[model samples]
Target chain A: MGTKRTLEVELSTTGLSPDGKPQRVPLVVGGDGGAVALEAPPAMEPEFEGEHMLINIGPQHPATHGVLRLVLELDGETVVRCIPHVGYLHCGFEKIGEYRQYNQIVPWTDREDYLNSIGNNCAFALGAERIFGIEITERCKVLRVIAMELSRIASHLVWLGTTCIDIGAFTPFLWSFQERENIYNLLEGWVGARLTTSATRVGGMAADIPDKWLEGLQGFIRTFPKTIDECERMLTKNAIWVGRTVGLGVMSPVEAVNYGLSGPMVRASGVAYDVRKDFPYLDYETYDFDVPVGSAGDVYDRFLVRVEEMRQSIRILDQAVKRLPDGPVNVDDVRIILPPKSKATSEMESMIHHFKNVMEGPRPPAGECYVAVESPKGEKGYYMVSDGTSKPSRWRIRPPSFVNLSAIPKMVEGHLLSDVIAINASIDIVMGEIDR
Target chain B: MSPSFTIVHPGTGSNATPVTPKNVPVSGGPVSPTAEAVGAQFPGVISRTVVSRGETTIIVDGARVHDVILWLHDDAQQSYDYLSDVTAVEHRDLSLPLEVVWHLRSLRYRRFIRVKVLIAKGAPLEVPSVMDIYKGADWLERECYDMFGVKFAGHPDLRRILMWEQYKEGFPLRKDFPLRGRFSRSEQLKNALAANPEARYSMEELSIADAFEELPLDMRRRLSEGEKVGE
Candidate 1:
């Protein structure tokens, strides 16, 4: 009889199990019925002194999206465990808001999530309004939806474009920026600022949508889907794209909910819960766009969810433009909303209100309200507390980037080191918000 | 009397803070069983519950905080599945000097609540970690500790998050700390550069660039040779 022979096989699910769950049965052998140990073959990385080699990536690495740091423990090519170190971008946003007045804090909120500046402004405005019990006009509601949806499109375009480049495809970025520049032009036309538009105000907006911006939006909408098609043509069925991303960074539905993922993150995990439909703030219920949910919560599914989201955002913009209401954007109430330049020059009270409003800021009634909006990244909420003072006692922002980035270690563990880039990009973190 | 008068408290006058009614029934009711389950299951954990603006604010006993959070999570039908945000407030003006607040949301019940714990005067800035129950709370607890100098017992790794690893002096977010930081961050950066000469960072990807606007206190303050950092 031949000496009992032993053969080595790489049990894809053998030594390393995805999702960091312990593999109870490690003795999965090949055709030779010889019992095996949990150890890998010589080809695999040798465990020296019972330790894995550690490598640190980014407080400045380009692929990290922003100044995120990762201390990854590796067994050769496969990552045994991933430890994420954030706070490289912390700015004390919550602490700073305590000193600034209610309306004065809008610009700071814009800096929190730079991509979705308008959405951040809108969420803060909604929370501030509720705390002050201010009811905005119908036109104001329509305009907010328009601005937010446009932001959603622009933000998603950046994500779709940058993430493709992150996964090694370069052409999609230029095509992606084309549509984004058009949207930014519209934002510039409406709110004088583009990337950091403190577009919306507490009671209403800064100004009515300037002159012919709506016509520009209509032009963008008619031509935007072709860009989406351009992206899909480049990546959707491409073997290189699918092979690298599909079935990677899988987060099950239960895990996704427990992780507190919202927006595209939770949607990719098949959770149909959207702040717009579930909570229904800012006349979001009135808009006719469907929430795009995915079955498998992998990187590919996340990509699909975001692409589909851009389409849905277009639908929302289309509806909003058709149903655009014409009225005074800001409330006529001089207390919360600033008086017009015409009124300020003519009347002493208006002038006094303007000066006080600019200097001292709107002293909202002392109470607390947590307003959550469906920002492109996730559910961005601002929890404001007023001690009946002009400045807020606590201005806490619930940034989705911070929360969503927390789930990365679980997603990236047991995968190859190269997959870290794919997984990180798929999550779409903006460290500005995470650090804030 | 007008409905508007009823809404805004008369005492606040023209700058009336929006009032969502002084209080509503939250600690007890036939409505949502979250408060009921918490009260029945974990006695003495939840002390006071204030319902305002159609939202609930629960004042929890700090001692049994971990148990309270665990019970709130594992329970069926009324699980506060989402740990929305964890932060601290310096209520220096109020009798209680420091208060930590937790915002929790339940997808099942589709309701949200704000839970608070007042750190007793002279008590060490420490709170039990809720990391085991909600993994997402890991960074949040660290952030609270970093900004407010609050400590989380049983935290896997708790250190200065936004600030540098060797940073001393005091917490920046505390009201006592000056807007321009006590230490000269530029001098500190120079020392860091001298110490770790190989530490190269792109300004765009670097956190220190933002740290300037953040740590712009007393730009004139020079580092004393006697003053030590990471001793």
Candidate 2:
């Protein structure tokens, strides 16, 4: 067998520095078997070092995943600094929530983080329910748990597919999206909407799962893990995937917590701070599931963490389906829950209750509450303040993507320009949430 | 009724099993232990501690919120290492003071606390920025400033985040700002049309290369004359 020879090319160009000095980086090629490397001159010229080129990516580019614009300062192919600009998709969702009734605001939550719209609905309902001091039925609690877990899997699937596409793996993208479509089918069957499933009301869900919906969910639960296993078989040890992802954007445990990274982003840094476990809600404490933690907080670790989370979500869904209770989906409170449609037309009291519920809306006592949930992205929270009115005095969305994306400049600074895409994909940002 | 779940801070190496709170009161419950600890550490700093909806909100003086938060982060007993959110609340009642809220969490001990500073009506809507404490505050503080016009004093790069740099419609989340916006439809359109798209690239960004020199003389003069093109 012939010996393989490695070619090393160190090609550089000369340009004028900001101070108008001639800056030259001479090209040198290795003749012997050597690896390709970009090497700077031992006695580097100050003018050459000072020549930093600025490039803008997106606000329209595909690699950004959304309308996110990033202005990068590059020294050669390495990123010197990255300044992200968002809000191109800003629609003032929070500002609008202040004017709408609590129930009306649930639909708007769907538009912010569209991938996790059902999870957002649940989080907002939990916050509003806390303020209203309403205890949901046992059936409602288990159903919400099911809804949240299903949406978590769906959101993670989107993240998996889109991130695979970003990193140049097309096969996994198709397989993941195919499974995601299955979950969407189940959601559409339940809520009559897929992408924007405003499935939960303030005190309970909009409606319970229809007849035999559990069968469909059980089918998904039984088959989804095989798809995840197939994805893992394809990409877990693939050289290109590992080369592009591992150790590219490393964040320490302290840095992850300090920067307010949450969900997989924080857990990947070995922080074990899942809101479902640390601050349980919707009977999450009663469920048995493991919060996956990764030692190295890199792009690969984030990928592994998210894939494991999808599996864990399936586990929760399986348990929820088996333990499904039989009862009313909404709270029994007349002030909040609308009267039954069958009774509303027949009874005057039911008609009056329905009229007042729709016209004036149920007013919670004057107070404020912040409810945080373990969203697919991170700790998704909805903060609401009611000044003794049907509408909120202030409505704030503690968007996980917005906080997670803030750490991008720190992660991308010293890496190659191409790694920026990998780091960003790992962040799994939905710009609708960030700009809202 | 009080909250059924207690706010228990676990000891080192011991994990605490937290359950969902049932029957949480509308107001008043078991206050977070940090509230009292913070109140004790900073005697005159904490004005009041309100337990509402099973959450503890310690109202701190506007001037000392940074100090109190710093202590919470540094203290072993109250290791609120994670900053959950930085936002402001503007009430519909115009007479009431605007409130700056910080949601802090301790990953180690599994605790959460809300720190608030009330910026009174007619007073400067400025709060000491926690950007120094939490790097995540960079954009959150900027967004708060953009939406509520609340200034974060020590923030290094507090600028309009969700809004354009030249946005002059006043803060969108403020009580006085109209829902449809300040200007009429035609006027808003005209302003949007007349906006210099070139100015969208900030002066600092343009200075990165020779792009700054390539700008028109009039635009350059206007930018140099302090037209506010990013921080």
Candidate 3:
């Protein structure tokens, strides 16, 4: 183990004296739980009031989206450089996923992107299922699509409401939450959990949809367009919203793809790269919906892209609901999915099968697959490497927010301080996904 | 509704099959061609190529990974532009202890190709950083270093990104590392915080501690004692 020692070093961050001259200072760096004492290296220069000032934003700021910290180097009103410091909410999800069973990892995926739990579940389930070489029933596939689309709408509502609040609009927040709540009301009935709805199991859903759940969704989809229209009236052409966000956070098409930005972030850059469309999964190819694209990769373009995406999601939901079938929701595999309640109660073999499946878990074939779902955020990918055992050898989550958030510094380097908040919102990051 | 979309429910589980044409991924997709192209381009560099479960993974020599990737980026016909993700895997039983997996997507071809590098088992688990080819690899490479203790030779600002500045414990993602960490700094941190009221607050760390405490204590103790939980 390393021992504690005192080391005095050159000071760059210590401001000039009242007379305006360089001053040397000794800073002590230590352990036993205390603030980091720093003496800037000779290569580094301290920020002076007249020249530049260093500002720390969030580890707890509303605009940051979560426990994200940014060390912004500000030269007057313009940002000279922006360094984002994340991992404040790191829970070692990858490590934990390696230890859990295939079915057990579903709930953990839900927490990665809390707003789009079902979407995250799909990515993991599909990845695991691919390795297992199992194609779920047609009904199960349609249900998976329905759950994913609902998650897209719910996550987008939160993004829309919060981004409005971030850019100094209040009324839309109320309107957006109302729409989000209706989805929650339906999901809670179907999935049992409101926020972290581990909605899907490895083969199919944990439980079949409740009676009349589709009716609620049908009503919501019919009315959600009106809410979108109302939201558009409030801010779509409003001078304040346009002035703040229109030209802010511009990322060129090549830059967007180069930086590995996906979802609407890349779409706003005129690249229509949606996992649902490009890399179709879970019967997305069967559904007819357009991938919305924006020519200008700006903050305003991102907003427009999201709104258009919501409309597309509604269209998918309409088709999926219309085609909802009467069949087994969960795969009827005794080794994979649990036995039906009717079978379990009557048949001894069915009960034993249920007991074995629950106590142990599905031991998929030894292989690996990287399955991605076009989640609300972007391409939510789960790269799973499974040994010939119940537990996965490696479970890697390529969270869209984590990768998308990496491009923020480039987007905000020369931008004004106020625009940083608006730009950050347009990226639509969820810290849970980013930190995981 | 299209008649093709309606899958005939033949049976359940092992016997069940999609009535419609199976949603089997397109095989001769651009990935297979690119895999062939890479093998042909760098004959010695590529050791093995496995196209399984609709994903193409090409294993290359750890020594020449950077050269192969550079070729992929610069080569006009086989130009792989998007570096989707960079991750590493650990297998204690294997001769090569670590394998750094890089997923690259060629947007022009609309396909994904996985390139991997195997690092020999040693103290310095290191690889070449591809930050120059893909700017997004900056944080991802740092994250690999932080989690797996795999040092990237040319990574700038290679500090611990996820863990605290003062963290000195072993890399948590290693195969030998216990799920319940061997060291318990909870008591020490609690005492330190009590003594210094003005100490910085990390709700994240505290929540993590809370989660660790929820696991079965006896099992965790045995796990920390280097005992395997189960087969």
Candidate 4:
């Protein structure tokens, strides 16, 4: 390696310099293997030239769906260089988690990936459980499976609705949302919150599932397949949708793996690696469901994979509900989880346990573990290191969106600018999770 | 729960019996030598008293940070190939200024370890970028750079992320930085107005007006009256 040098250069707009005159100023451009200098050249005006035109999509555009902006360098309609500028909704979630207790972080997880709050809750809960070596009850696992599957379906519905809108199909958005509202109702009945479901606790669920809530979920499961069929009938073979997606932004299996792509992105590229199947966590191994993979590796393939996944999630939910045991939802270990509110007021030991757990938190054996689960977006992994403390000494989330979004430049390198929207929608990025 | 067990290496084609619960100890001693080296190489790097657990972390000095990281990654015996994540801890009140941590794992050995580098608040607060060995370090390094302002010397792109453009004044994740939202207008909007002063209405003003028009009549009146919009 050679010694690096820093350079300082000045950039000034041709206008008043606070004194109402065209004055030059200095700008710093630090780099290595370079020189530092400033020179006054002939007063020649600079014009935006060249075939490539710089276009800003938005920090507030309909297609972005959230505060996401993309600066595209386009040669005619073809994208030359694309840069995804994020952080319009940076809440510093991980930093916030540092201050909150282990259980308190559950609510924050919901907001990180609002579309799949249940899955987010599961990931965080499982990570914390692994750290503390807490064994969740079989009933808790079954309930988690049911909730996560429902969340998967709801997430896919939003993806379908918004993706259709992105591709100029309007009616499907409303239709999908109508069905999605039913699933949200089911979620609310159980979690007491629809979108931001802070449902899961460190050792188990925050509470047991009510019978009526389970009944409603069973009803939803029965009716959801037909709704998925209705969605497919509208968009699957539609000439416009087929034309827009069939062969656009294709990525090969090798490239997908190299880029660390997961979920629908890798499935669309013909790899059959789902964390649920490959690395079973939360009793997912007991459930029999297919990991739907695609062959085309195009935007259409991604769309098809998600559509099939919703059906598979329904299958898993059906099995989970049927096998859901009639027993305590939480483990018997009172050291990790809190006692019931009623017990805390009545029993002395329970009160002391709650106080101790809240004040000191569960001291996880000094250890480190990496737990990965299949979230709606992709493989969401939490790599946690604990130093025998209540809080994680180091908690690093390997967000699927961040990894999946990395492949965006590769996906759209040679494609047209318009195709970028299709590619972005296909990736299904939630910037909250990505920026966290 | 039962203590599940397996023999590490059984004699050729011979079946190994599972270790019985009666034979199992309440706790076991540290098993891996690599783990022991982790403690020996940097004695005081970790708190002296070691806990008997699956994972152990060693906090190294910022000056020897690059060497320790390289050893963890490239040492033939250790072979910690995968760089899982890199994040920083902002302890403004700690004796050491700040801590930058890296979690490394070896898929072959089925082992995981943590290496931390501590830096004080000063000019050139830099750590060597592990991006050369682990491609995954690219974003993790950038994130640490963006949030904690911990400079990774060889990182390809060291610009601020998760913050608005031209937001260079402070590292938001630092404990001292207030959690409350900033009240100042964006640099882009301010510069735009400064360039074209005749454009009297600010972007915020226009957005508010548009939002008001879009809302239902009852809601609009409530918002205008300063009642909570969601309520």
- Which number leads on DockQ? 2
RMSD of each: 12.8, 9.7, 15.8, 17.0
Per-residue lDDT for B183 in model 2? 98
The digit string of per-residue lDDT tens for model 1 on A1-436 reads: 0011122232322245687876633333333223222111122345664435556688788899988888776777777667676776667777788888877789998998898888788788888887877778878888888888888888898898888888898888999998899999898998999899998787998888878888998999999999999888767755457666756677777788777777888888877767787667877767778887877677877898999999999999899899988888887778788898998999999999999888878877666777788899998888777888888887888888888988998988777788889999999899999888
Candidate 4 lDDT at A259 equals 55
Clash pairs, model 2 backbone: none
lDDT of 3 by residue, A1-436 (tens): 1112122222222347779997633232332222223211121233564545556688888888898887676767677677777887888889998878888889998888999988788778888888877889888889888888888999999999999999999998999999999988888998888888887887888888888888888999899999999998777655456656755677777788788888999888777777776567877877889888876577877998999999999999999999989998777678998888899889999999888888888888776778777888887888888777888888898888888999998988777788889989999999998888
Task: Evaluate candidate 4 and give its CAPRI docking class based on DockQ.
Answer: incorrect
Every candidate's lDDT = 0.75, 0.84, 0.77, 0.69
- Residue A321 lDDT (model 2): 85
Candidate 3 C-alpha lDDT tens digits along B1-231: 111111111111123222222444523223567778878888888888876677788999887889889998878776677788888898645664588999887665556788988777764688899988888888888888888888888887786677664455668888888886655679546543433212222333223224444434653575466643211
RMSD of 1: 12.8
Quote the RMSD, in angstroms, for model 2: 9.7
Best by lDDT: 2
lDDT of 4 by residue, A245-293 (tens): 7566666665565456678887877777576765467667678899878
| Model 1, runs deviating above 4 Å | A1-51, B1-33, B92-94, B184-231
lDDT per residue for candidate 1 within B1-231, as digits (tens), equals 100001111112123222222222212333334666678887777887765455777778888877888777777756677788888887536565588888887766566777788887788988888888777887788778888899999998786666665656578777777666676889756755654312322222232223434322332132122322232
Candidate 4 displacement at residue B219 in angstroms: 34
- TM-score preference between candidates 2 and 3, better one: 2
Tens-place lDDT digits, model 2, residues A286-333: 899998887767787799999999988988888888898888888888
Better of 1 and 3 by DockQ: 3
